[model samples]
Target: MNKYIEIIKNAYTGYWNYLKHELISINHWDNYFYGLLCISLIVWLLEICFPWRKNQSIFRNDFWLDTFYMFFNFFLLNLIVLIALSNTAAQFLNDILSFIGISISSFQLFDVDDLPKVLGLFIFFVVGDFIQWNTHRLLHRIPWLWNFHKVHHSVKEMGFAAHLRYHWMEPVIYKSLLYIPMAIIGGFDAQDVAIVHFFNIAIGHLNHANLGWNYGPLKYIFNNPKMHIWHHAKNLPEHSKYGINYGLTLSLWDYLFNTAHIPYNGRDIELGFEGDENFPKDFIHQELYPLSKK
Candidate 1:
């Protein structure tokens, strides 16, 4: 009993320490929160001006659940798990290299200072987005991943806030996959990652907002609100016909891979899965429902 108590106490202390480090060491809380605020406002205005589904309410279906998801993601999701995972991976890799007498610091690919700030920013966006694009594809194609990903798609009435609706497990899986590619690229520090995250926060909301513009020629390059709405469309025959439009910030990948799908004026496509009515309404149920019996 004493041994078990000590083990529990140690785990609690470790968790508390991690929580403190995450809150203090990782700057950019202002950038993330305020950036999302501005994006949400812009998207909200656009939705009011040009909503795709006129009948969908300002307080749409599952609005509170989405709000819960947004706050949870902001407050909890990306902090402890990602930081701990990276630190542990770093320590493990360092230990292995130390055994082999190999110093990892000798291999910085690009000097972050030498590169133009704009170029660094672009590279940050492209690399991070590529990782996310692949993650999105895996979530749709892999059955096990699909179980967790279904929470996002279950939101039948899509809105700007729905951008943050995702399983908490997502960062763990995606961040684990991102580590190798990030190491290969090198020279990107926390600031570079923060900027890309800021850009994503804005762009992500815009893509999910109810606005109905495809941005003409730009649609081929960037994933716009219209193209993304179709991604959530349940009744669209192409859900099975073609696994369509899984790009994160850019539509270029979907075009290159032949997963892109946007018919002319395709704004009327139905959102959410056909039988998603069986999906739970509350936050707790949605989190656990995916783990229930097959």
Candidate 2:
């Protein structure tokens, strides 16, 4: 009980300190707080310059709402709740493993130091993306998870900020599943993960932006706006009942697993699900939406 209380208190303090640093300090260019703003600005400019949907307004539907989601999910919820919780969970798991006379370090599949830094980072990126890809499919296929994921699909219009408009629980789910696999292939540092993280953020913003870029032949490798817009299509084909285009950073997994589907240009396809009209529009309501019986 005391340990839990200490954890909570530390979480509160850590949240405030991190928040202050992120907001006030400009020393680190790689900080996510700044990175998110920079990426959003760049993508917004791209959307303004070469919008696929010419008729879509610059301040499209729920633009501000999605922007709020971006900061909330990335910083507020993450620093305040997830950081301490994840640390405590890791410690608890390690303690349990110690009691069982096992060391988590022994589970490493290979020493990342043995490979070149670039190759190691590439492997880490691909493996991490594959884990997220599978986790994304679970969000659509599982009823309980789909309830939370619906907050993302409720987007009526696509924008770069829309990329981060997902329920906070999503990180918990994605990171929890990613932890084991990533740890098993260990030796990469925070900088390595940050490189991949920021890159994925950029790609994700592009994928959700109102930019009709297919990357032509590269479409089979990297996910693009044209390919990802179909992922949010309200009317999916019967064959893809659970959803399709479950790619995170790369479309290679989708193609390899036979889940890739692009029947048309998808520039003007209707977004959201069947009953999206009734979905909550406000942030607070949407946060509690998944817990509701409805």
Candidate 3:
């Protein structure tokens, strides 16, 4: 009982300190709070200047709702709950492993420490993206996961901020699956991969933005607005009952695995799923909608 209490206390303190550092520290320019703000502002400016749907309003439908989701999922919820919970979970997992005499540190596929810095970072980035891509597919294929993922697909109009409009359970799922694989390929610090993280965040914003960019030849390598819009299209391909274009950062997986689908320019495609007209429009209801018996 004392051990559990200590873990909970330490988790809250550690996350609070980390949050404070992220908010005020200037020593690290790679802070996520500022990074998210900068990227959001840049992409939003692009959308305003060059919106693919010319008739779409600057304040598109559900715009503020999605904005709230962005900050809520990114910072507010993390500060209040997720950060502490994740920390506690990590400590508990470590304790369980210790009890079984299993040292996770002893089981690396390869240590990034011995490799060249860029190569190590590249390996970590690719593997992490691949994991997310597969997890994304599961979110569509599995019924229960899709219920949680519905918050993201409920977007009636896509925009840059829509990138982060997901159920809070998503991070729990993504990070839980990510932990073991990342642990096995250890020695790289979070700071070491900040560049990749920021780049992915930018791509994610672009993918959800009201832009029509397909990246031309790079469409095969990277995900872009054109390819990703179809991911949110109201009408899924008859063949793709689960979903299509499951790529999170890279399009390579979708192309290689044959899930890629873009029959034509998707600029005017209607967004959301079949029953989306009935989906919750407010933040509070959207969060709880997934967990409801309905």
Number of the top lDDT candidate:
2
Instruction: Sort every candidate by lDDT, greatest first.
Output: 2, 3, 1
lDDT of 3 by residue, 1-294 (tens): 687778678777877788788888766778988889899999999999999998989889889988888888888787776776776777788888999998778777899989999899899999999999999999999899999999999998899989999999999999888888888999878787788889999999999998989899999999999999999999998999899999999999999999999999999999999998899888889989987944
> Which digits, one per residue and each the tens of the lDDT, describe model 1 over residues 1-294?
454445455555676675566555545464555556667778888888888889889888877788779867765654534454555656667667889997566554665557898897787678878888999888888878888888889877778889989888777788877876676567777677777777787778888877777778998988988888878878655445425788888998999888887775666666777578898878888889778936
The regions of model 1 sitting more than 4 angstroms off are 1-30, 93-108, 236-242
Q: Global CA lDDT of candidate 2, please?
A: 0.91
Model 1 TM-score? 0.82
Per-residue CA lDDT of model 2 for 77-129, tens digit only, reads 87767877776777677778999998889898897879999999999999999
Backbone collisions counted per model: 0, 0, 0
**lDDT, model 1:** 0.75
Output the lDDT of residue 189, model 2.
Answer: 83
Query: What's the lDDT for all of these models?
Result: 0.75, 0.91, 0.90
**What would the TM-score be for candidate 3 when compared with the true structure?**
0.95
Pairs in clash, predicted candidate 3: none
